[model samples]
Target: MTVVELEVTKSADELAKTYIVKGILSEKKEDDALHVAIATCAEMDALVTWNFKHLANLRKAELFYSASLEKGYLKKLEIVTPMEVSNYES
Candidate 1:
């Protein structure tokens, strides 16, 4: 098993702050932003979340995607639910 640790660096902090200040996410949901930051910082292609109210919604995803681009994160971050990307057989 491979372990990936997410660190809170200066850039990640700034990204998280941007997410909060831009109203993309509430301050109480900072961890959600941090999670996104981690994914963005790692240059991940997608970020799966169960938080529909914030991360998994179309509007919020658009805002976060735009913000990431504006912040120089070139790759588009696909915010989606586990079910959306899952390969579970019924």
Candidate 2:
């Protein structure tokens, strides 16, 4: 159980605003909230969580990946679940 720190940055408020506008809540909202902030700062490798309802679903992951790509945020952003990473033997 490795816990990764999600420090709030200068852009955190703006990130939360964006998610709120999009009507996302709870885990989904939190995941995007953190990712948006990280995207703004370009300071994270992977966002590991177990919240498949939001962050870990393949469909949602792809959408997030594509959105980040379009915004030039993909270089530093990756969203995956703990189980997804753990499943990889290598």
State the lDDT of candidate 2 residue by residue for 1-90, as single tens digits. Answer: 434556676565555555445444354467566665564455566677677786666766565555445544545456677755653433
For model 1, how does the per-residue alpha-carbon lDDT over 1-90 read when each residue is reduced to its tens digit?
Answer: 233676788998899899999998899999999999888878877787788987899998889889989899988788889888864445
| Candidate 2 TM-score versus the reference | 0.56
Collision pairs in model 1:
none
Q: Give candidate 1 misplaced runs (Cα > 4 Å).
A: 1-3, 87-90
Give the count of colliding residue pairs in each prediction.
Answer: 0, 0
Model 2 misplaced stretches (Cα beyond 4 Å): 1-6, 24-32, 65-76, 86-90
Superposed by TM-score, candidate 1 places the C-alpha of residue 90 at a distance from the truth, in angstroms, of 15
**Would you estimate the TM-scores of all the predictions?**
0.85, 0.56
